[model samples]
Target: MTLEYLDYTIVFLSLGSSIAIGVYYGFFNKSKTSEDYMFGNRQMKVLPIAISLVASQINPLTIIGFPSEIFVFGITFGFHFIGMIFVVLILIYLIIPIFYENNITNCYDYIEKRFDRRTMIFLKTLFFILGYLYIPVYSYISSQALSFVTTGINVHLINTIVCSICVMYTMLGGLKAVVWTDVLQNFVMFFALLFITYIGVTEVGSFKETFSRASDIGIFEVNTNLDITSKNTIWNCFLSGVLLFTCLIGFNQSCVQRIVSLPTIKDSRKAIILFFIGFIITVSIVCILAVVMAAFFNDCDPLKSGEINQSDNILSYFVQKLSINTRGIQGMYMACVVCASLSTISANINSLSCTLYKDCIKPFIPNSKNNNLIPKIIALLSGVFLICSGFVVEILNSTAIQIITTSLNLVFSTYASTFMLGFLAPRIHSRAMFLSNIVGFIVILGVIVKGQFFSGRVQYEPIEKTFSTDC
Candidate 1:
């Protein structure tokens, strides 16, 4: 068969497999009630939930964005993990136990019970906005990654196809299918990164040589200086990454939802502990890959090469270059990218569906109305949001990418106090929790509006362009 035909066949088969898995899980093995769909009957094993936790949070953005960050900044980017370790430990000892004890459906439900009704509503709305905004940035990045292999494909069309597939599995099979597929995709994604890193380092020469070049370029320094205004300084990363990852690991709906799926709180905590070990590997592996890319293509000067037009394209550039020599490695690489993207999108669609159903719809609908409408509305809206996100991703240009990722990170930062207080110190008033979510969201908006309208542009040129000849 011709190479193009082969590429087309592999892509179609891989995507088809995803759909078949979703259909099998949805029709043949679905839950009898909403709880099963949302939490896998709350009887999930530690290993699968552990795998899905890692898969869900580590999306295409990690595949593309993290390596892209390392490509430009080098080893200084690794310090973000310094904070992640602390955050993960805190969750194991303090946060996960609360959810396990309470048999919580939505994390926000705890906020209401511990705090007040208004506080619950406020926290959920804040998280919903934060999640919607943040997820699409990754969605847009995923679309762009596909564009790397298929040069002229429209990004919106790619997003539509991806988001549609994600919604299908999520809306149909629910978390069961999402987790099952993620287990398989995580292996695919992990091996793909390892393969790319190996090839990249070999292409460039020895690790010592690569590090030498990176140091000569001044990109290898640990950079422990403080500068809250900057994005990547060591001190800034340590401080902000603490809150950023705390929200992500401790309280974000995606991670929390998976942890609760365990058969017991102890198993849930075990999965969380295992996640930390895997997270460290994830951070180290990606950082090394980024450093390798820096060495291999350091001379290519992405901006000079015109590949730096968008920061998200950096990993794709490296992947395409690395795989160019082999017969179908490019196709396999692209499949890996698609799998990575769809895994997170799939988990989010499932999580968002559960959030809307258990947290929003079921809360207000009458007993009869709940039985009649909840599942149908869950399925329909999940499809709608995915389709809408596909279109929304198209309009997300460079500036939008920065605004969305940074803004969502900040919004979730608010959860640090709100969720921690609700879970650990239920004595905190509902008024305080409600006020905190509102204030936290306002703080994030205040920064954005102030920066956009009153202050001059934040001048967040893509990370790679920091070394541009013009600069």
Candidate 2:
């Protein structure tokens, strides 16, 4: 189960290449203007940017979390893909044009143009805070994956190492480096999943056998319950997916920056379409891998057998067991996890830097010659913050996926709503928007409090357990 020297070499080379790419862009091909550094001179090709968009969106959370979700729940989670298609269509037709037409570096720039500086500042502050909180979860997930591969190393040290590498590259390369590395990482991620799925299915005899075993245990059950509180119902999946994508792809700064980095609106739209294709394929593969893992362990469930400490670790456990004598497979899997984490962390750092310098720091130091240095410094500071926050995550000892999902919901629940108000309801006065935002914020807070403290009225009953002995 331990990683061999060759396995370690494979992972090191993978990560090392990412840093090298960052160094190449950050130093040798230095971006002269803020535009070049922040938006890649607006000359990036659609294909790489498309791949980057997909890569940045698929992080450790999706890589690890999605499989864990499918394992614990069922195939009903796949219905979210339907909702994703709906959201991406909206983005291509309605959202990207506005941002591209405005030629904005930060997504919040449209807020200032549409409403007033006060409203823009409020949303910018929220983005900055939420982004800061979110980056740590990425680090925590990367460190967790690193722990599986390098069991001798401490998780805290792993976090520091992973975050340091991400910061170094992001500080050096800027947006171009992030995009190019994402192209590479996305391939690694796909290959890893393909390899794991192939091995898992082969071990289970065939794809037919795999599904037959899964179906025997009712893994194909779709949640048709109408109850709003039901976690994975079709309605819940569709609505939550719509909201999640509206916030993430429609309004999130990290996503918007990548979309706008392309040369033209047409290219950005194309990138969105390409991204959707890649997203669906990759997500479907991961979900199938989840079912495959379930089939592989149908007889000896890892959670029931206490072979793994957490559901999130089930994939890692499966990888280790499958890679007992298989040399580079484990390293490849670890590389996949690292690539997923690094792409996301780097994108967030770059986007957050862009947000801070453009919205917060530049106003004070207007027309300064050293304005370019602001983003670099902020990128470095962001790395340190992520590392520190990662330690806090470790201290909390929470599941990375749950913490991330909850945090995103709390931080971004009203973001898409506010953006829609600005974009679609232009005649709405800034005062009215401001007041509405305040009231909406209060209502969201009340709902959160109610869910946390006054949830006695609704209770979740566990699904009946039925394990299959036909592995």
**Predicted candidate 1 versus true structure: per-residue lDDT over 39-75, tens digit per residue:** 7778889888888878876777777777777666556
TM-score of 2: 0.95
Error of 1 at 62 (Å): 1.0
Model 2 regions lying over 4 Å from their true place? 369-371, 454-465, 469-471
Q: TM-score for each prediction?
A: 0.90, 0.95
Q: State in Å the error of residue 165, model 1.
A: 1.3
Q: Count clashing residue pairs per candidate.
A: 0, 1
Top-lDDT structure, candidate number:
2
CA lDDT of each prediction against the hidden true structure: 0.71, 0.83
Clashing pairs in 2: 26-172
Q: Estimate, for each residue in 319-375, the C-alpha lDDT of model 2 and write its tens digit.
A: 887887566888888888988989999999999998778766777886754357889
RMSD of each: 3.3, 2.0
